[model samples]
Target chain A: MVSGHSSYVMKHHDLPIEVHDLTVSYQKKPVLYGVDLEIEEGSFVGILGPNGAGKSTLIKTIMNMIKPNGGYVKIFGDRPRAGIKRIGYIPQKESVDWDFPVTVFDVVLMGRYGHHGWLSRIGKEDRNKASECLEQVNMLAYADRPIGNLSGGQQQRVFLARALAQESAVYLMDEPFAGVDAVTEKTIISILQEMKKAGKTLMVVHHDLASAKEYFDQLLLLNMRKVAFGSVSEVYTHELLQKTYGGKLAVLSEMATEVAKNPEP
Target chain B: MKNWVIIFGGLLISSSFLEAKQIGSGEDLNWLTQAERFIEMKDPSIRKVALGALLMGLSCGLIGSYVVTRRLSLFGDTLSHAVLPGIAVGFIWAGEKENFSLLIGAGIAGFAGVCCLSLLKKFTKIHEDSSLGIVLSAFYALGICLLTRIQKVGYTDQSGLDSFMFGQVTSLSSGDIISLLITLLLIGLFITINFRQLLVTGFDPQFSKSIGIPNDFLQFLLWMLIAFCVISSLQLVGVILVSAMLVIPAATASLFAKRLKNYLVLSSLLGAGAGISGTFFSFLGKGLPAGPLIVLFSAFLFLVILFLRPEKGIIVCWLKARSERSRIIIENTLKATFKILEQKDFQENEITSLEIMKKRGLSRREVEREIDKLASSGFCTKNLSANDEANLPPQTVMILTPKGWEYACKIVRNHRLWELYLTNEAQYEPDHVHEDAEKIEHVLGEKTVRQIERLLKNPKLDPHGKFIPSITDIHQGNLPRPS
Candidate 1:
């Protein structure tokens, strides 16, 4: 249960993540039809919608993991790569191979590689910081454990630990709680609560409608286009939920596939 | 005399327009004699046929390790075999075996094969495995056919011809040694300058790419090195067995190492060892083939280490599993004993240890070890009212201190709560639920158990009709249930 509201002193005052008239396509069919959103700092924002809502594609475009066809996405009033150091990202856990021969310590150390640029070695200070991040996630006991041996929830925590080691100002987590145990979920929420207290912004791609109200402060209701974007209390109503996720999921999925195939538009 | 005639003849045929730098004179003859003596090791007239073989082995060992670890072993083999047609065509045109023209033709052909493979992979839907297989077999077969055509054209000496196929390690001269040395130096420089980049790219290309490392460029560089190394070592290992030279050493080293640097270094050492040992064996055994001998030695080392290494070996994994099962049984017995003590309140006298063991369905020896472990850990006290050692019935009633009872109850509570959570909340089908919950309950902490209890709204019974423990301790209560 995250329950503290601290005084928000915004130097920029504007929303940390802002997207305006964002349109994306694959080939020539539009996937995102003028989707727009705004998210504030010190907020836990859940990007909520059913499968194939272009929710993942939208985030990837915002992160510059993929180039958008036509859109404007600003993180801290700049491009995603410019603010990469300030933005920590946890990609879907399944995207990586667990059988890869690396220990928990080795994987977490890679977070600092971005900081220590190419041809530069990681220093003692970076190592100490990585250790601290591992401690925060309670994964210090398994620091030397091969990543392959860990359970699904443990692997997710290790990924989260890597992001924490980055010590970024914002976090974008894609499906952090998917296949995670209840305890691991609580651990993640508590860490997010602490980050929130420290005035860091977090955007999570979330499923599990039952816990959406309990977990999120702000919500981006998406279904290939902007359904709603506001505080969860304002945007997470039954009507908006239905619009964002219910009957529109199948139509959005078909549109997403067609759009994915037609990327040029 | 035949070797010299073939070489000079080939040289004249390729660069006939360029003047020969004054036929072998006094100074050159003296240098050649010293080189031949050094190789012979005390033989008066070019003592050792094995020296040429040794130099070839050394070059192949050094460069082959990198190729194997990078998974470019097949590429090495394909490129090696593809050089045959170049050798054949160079000989056919020059009317004699010529090193320079053959090398040029081989380089062009090898590069052509690489280009074809990459283009096919990029432009077509055919997978890389099938594509490489097609290219390797087709080019190699063409080379063999060209070799047959060249052999029939009245060139009977065939000194250079024999070296390209199965390899003529014994025929290596001082000139061949110079080429091998140059290739070694190039490979050493590559491994030194970009060691870290090569390692990271090999281990995880996606991660290297994400961190803004130019992985594609590095991959291209790596493939280029592979091509260079293959061309250099093909004379020594031959087209057919070159892949063995590349793959065996790295495969052997992986069994011995966990880190990338150690694996690379160990691979080199294994390769060098195999090369040296195979050379020695080939010398002693008269006609024993060196390439296959070296590969066999490496394979033998890998198998020995795989089955025998201390911590992570096959034998160790088996032993660890057996011990783990025994430990789990003992831990559970201790847990069951503590449970009985809490329920009975330590008031019943003359309660034999056997009674507890029978109640828990544990063996007597297991129960005894559990009691000993509990006593040693200070979880319980034993031998309080001592009497006659053997004849007097032993006071076997077990009692747990507050600390022990709390720990025991925590475990029991976690187990029951998980069973309920798995059955109801997780929607795990009933028959499959118990074993998963059983394993998970032992590892989960009180904090998680509390969270699960709250999520299930302090559920009274599991889906299987077993009662779940309620959180009683105020300090370790439940989290607020989601609305």
Candidate 2:
């Protein structure tokens, strides 16, 4: 199961991730407010929202990279820091410096850093797992090449392999499909699907609505709050989509128009 | 940087800007004549200077790699400059120029500068570059004013403070060496214990943070180390120019080293080598200072590497580009020849150079040059055809050899297959696919061609209905080989 925590007694009936009453603000702008959602195990849930709706910020808050002004996150019924060893994090592609002078193998090997003691040497098992992860992404042939030499798609695959090497039960990907070629998009989706089949909980921040409907079995619609969070069929409705995509100004204007049409009856 | 180069050039021009009186006033020692004595173990002074320089180079170069890779070269400059006030304050605080006090004071000032940079970024409307410039010049000016005030007070021991400008290698006390040893050991241990954390945090802070790595703590620790590195170097390369020591060796390493581990090792070696050579040259030149000369040598090394590094050097890249351009021209000419042959339905085995020129829209001479290139490469055979003696121009007819035909068919096949794949799989419009396929044709490998061929179900025609040379067509130009 790749359970990283040896001593923490993980609860048997807990959701993979439970974010309760989360509120985050950047300066004075409220990016996310009171966002609450529970992610089930083995569910490939896509967080869908328009730009500036705080999808990535929400994910970051769950990972504890950004602390919410209010509310909390519980992974395996534990604080994020205590339960993070079992979480595989794939950040946005734009977040990394591609010119960094590391080979594909070197990057994937970093996943084993958590497993090995801080001062202990990397063992044979770490090397085998790294290669196996690379092989899963069909990128073993490029293991020796510097990550900068690869194309955008190949670079994404290398990063995916690195996350795969972590072998965690929970995968948090932030816009993994952004800027990748079509073939790479398909390859990543298929791999994520395989991860889900093996009982991994996958949370992806996706921008494309059409592909979101096709890829994710569960959908979390967010517009500065928890607008909707449920099964794909339950959440991906015309009314909910219009509500989520509609801006606060548009919603206010629509409400006013309804009041004017009813003439205060 | 423009600012740095001009200053170094200024040092080279005005070499006498530093005082003629060196540290210790051992005039008439004839250091140039006694240069062979530099490595003699009998002289403890020489050994101390060499070891101090080596230690400075080792730590500066190793830490400088992190600075350069993290895009913090300018920050290093700012931090080094920011430490000046602290040095002056340390002199005042100790009432004497003690190495330990100066180290502590400079470290505090350097970190203060880092804090100012982050604070400016967070709270102010000032841009990052402007903030760096503001912090750098303001602190430096304040330190200079303090130094001048101290000089006006006329303390005899203040002579030691003057060495902080250009550095006096002869002033390397045994105590200074001890501090340097301790600094190097601490730096080495820190990097060793936290290599992966520093690397991931530097490359992708957000990802490292998301993975539960303490990115802020690591960054804070790195800044502390950089501060210490700058302070330790003040005795070897003064405050204003020490950042160059941190930048140049690491830059030279980046020119050739493809991995971070190699970059770190090579940077240290380059730093040490430059330091020793620069000191040796100064020793040979007698009254010359070592710090500026070391920087000049480092800059020289950087230029050499930029031009001559094996893989990505400008000269190598230029040469490769030239060869690749010529290959493209040769391939394009072959494709044109194949098109001409197809126009005649392969009924005629030879086409005149004038007709080829017309098809390629080139002048007669240009077409002849291309044809000659094709013929010399054994891709085609050219015949005089009796020169059409009555005509106004001489004409030569060219026929493709089997090797030429095979390559031509390969290019054409790749072009058409790509066009088909883009149209069918990628959903590119047929018209939009042609321009992209034109550029992609010469670069597609045989394996990709086979994959596309299989993907397209071996289609006979492209979107425009042009014949795509299939596997059968490719083998037609195959001939018996000697092997």
Candidate 3:
């Protein structure tokens, strides 16, 4: 696997995330329209948007969880399925049933599913990798505890640890800080920064405007479409944020919000 | 009217076996003798039936783990009900109760039911629950019409077809058991081959897709396996009660398991356990159907787990809360005693009950009762004053023993330190910290107390300008305690 460095980008090579005129819809209603983006390697990017602004839709489309109707997503200049093994995804915590009969360790070990074959038993290397990820999130103490027995913060950390154990070059996190305690938020941000330092690209869907400036080096301002995408000081301006959050696309936003909350396959 | 007649006829046949045994004995069947007969495994027919029950339980319970966990309990019910038509068609096509014909027909009908569900979801605006209800009742009605029509035709080979509705476990031949054995082996091998991928897909589909897992294929395979399980167990548990076998044993094991592997293993055991016990009791009563009897046994098992299991059980949670409530009460009483001593500037160790009543805002009787509780716990002693008999009754004064004084000081320190910490670390207003600290003081562990002290730099004064007692002063029970 090629290291995700922008030296390749400077040589006009494949970007970590390359999207051109992507359009996505659900139930014959559009959620994302004509969005374009290119993310450099090792950049800590925060996608700041209001509810139903298609932030999650964009990430899902990129991962091929949802296909774009208009355009396409390319990771390192290939189709998503071909490049999906190089990406780690941490979905919203509310998306899963915590009452499932699986321990924190078992959840983390699931991150290694892509690394090994389906028939092979979970080896010792996978166990060690999972615990290492748990240790990074300060959840090693709760590794043996059932997922339902954990608090909300611990559940969030378990998913984050799973993402870490995936050991992918690109990480996509959806609302990692939502519903977690202040201490857990701090730990997650620090880990994201560490990942950025290690030449890994990180894209986080963040809702808080105040912390968005401090947490991310780049910001992807989105509403129903791409309002702005650039450095935090440039795209995070008040004018652009107002344009993204303003109710110009009321019908589109409302329909997309309902669709996102009750997604059907 | 016809449906009701068919159902009643099936019931009458089920109960008639017991009537024959009762008439032979001229009384109730001997339960002890039946139990000995079952345990001896001396009869080949009895052994075959028992083995058949055990096999059904193991496979249904194993597959049921996935059914409940995937939120497909209702789907399992619909699928089981929908296979009735296939069973009837297979019986007519083969001109007998042929296992191979029945298996193929059931598998086709089950798969067709799933396909219909997908089509309904894709083409129509009808929701999932309504679609399932339509398919289940529709297929079931078709099966009922065929069954009643066949009985009207009156063929000799149709003599044992009613057993399909409510199983006649005694009628299971060795051929039936062999087919069931093969089906279960296939289910086991499939699960082992695709265990990790199936688990990840079940828990989180989007995440699985991101990792390039073929989620749709795995789900289709799982649906097929569920159909196989229901089909194989039909002769032992029957169609109407088959879903109970799938859901109950898994739910029973979920109470004890914290992981998927444990859920699978423990559910299989509980399934086997219910099977043996139900078969035993059915043998004992001499008239009980295995379907209802097995379901009842598993339901009883679930109730036991709900009430008696450790940690997550309702009874255990109630008991834990009760103890926590009493501990909070004890801590509050100790804090009241400390505040009484503080009001006097720590000039004495003994406090009058009137002072406690005023400090704790309790009635005089309440204060005396609290003191009695403290005395019994070895925290304090109660003495009657000489002037107590002067005013129609003796006056009570409580003297704290060293242990009592130590606890009192510790409670005071915890309260003050929490108040200080809230104002400093949490940025709470000074006046707002007391109410929150009221609850936090009782639960703060020693490690947290040390952290609070360190963060506050060992403050001697709380937000309200009260002197925070030290642990050493608490142990010494010293009046006018030093900083």
Compute fnat per model.
0.10, 0.67, 0.80
Alpha-carbon deviation at B99 in model 3, angstroms: 1.7
Q: Model 2 in CAPRI terms: which quality? A: medium
- Model 2, stretches more than 4 Å misplaced? A1-13, A247-265, B1-16, B20-35, B39-42, B318-483
Report the number of the highest-TM-score candidate.
3
- Candidate 3's displacement at residue B281, Å, is 0.7
User: In model 1, which runs have C-alpha deviations exceeding 4 angstroms?
Assistant: A1-39, A72-75, A246-265, B1-111, B154-158, B171-205, B312-483
Q: Which pairs clash inside model 3?
A: B388-B394, B388-B395
lDDT of 2 by residue, A97-161 (tens): 98888888988988877665567887899999999999999999999998888999998898899
- Residue-level lDDT of model 1, residues B270-379, one tens digit each, is 76677656544544433455555656676777787788888889999999899777556545655576446545553542334665677688777766667777667666
Put the candidates in TM-score order, highest first.
Answer: 3, 2, 1
TM (B chain), model 1: 0.60
Cα displacement (Å) at residue B316, model 1: 5.4
Question: How far in Å is the alpha carbon of B100 misplaced in model 2?
Answer: 2.4
Tell me the tens digit of each residue's lDDT in model 3 across B1-483. 967787566445444433211101223758888788778988787677778778888888888999989988888988987898898898889988777897788888888889999999999999898999999877876776676667777766885666666666766777779877876898789788888877887788778888888889988888988998888887777777789999999998888888888899988888888887777777776456666788789999999898989988989999999989877777788889888877777777778888787888899898888888889989888898765556656668888877787787888899999998988889999999999889888888888888888888888999999989866565565646312
What does DockQ give for each predicted structure?
0.14, 0.52, 0.60
lDDT of 3 by residue, A1-265 (tens): 1112333456333677888889999988999999878788888999988899999999999988998899989887788888888889999877787788888999999999888866777889999999999999999999999888898988998898999899998998899999999998898888889989999999999988768878998888888898888777566554566677784546435544544575422
Q: Which residue pairs overlap in candidate 2's backbone?
A: none
lDDT of 2 by residue, B81-153 (tens): 8988898899999888888888788888888898899999999999888999999988887676667667667
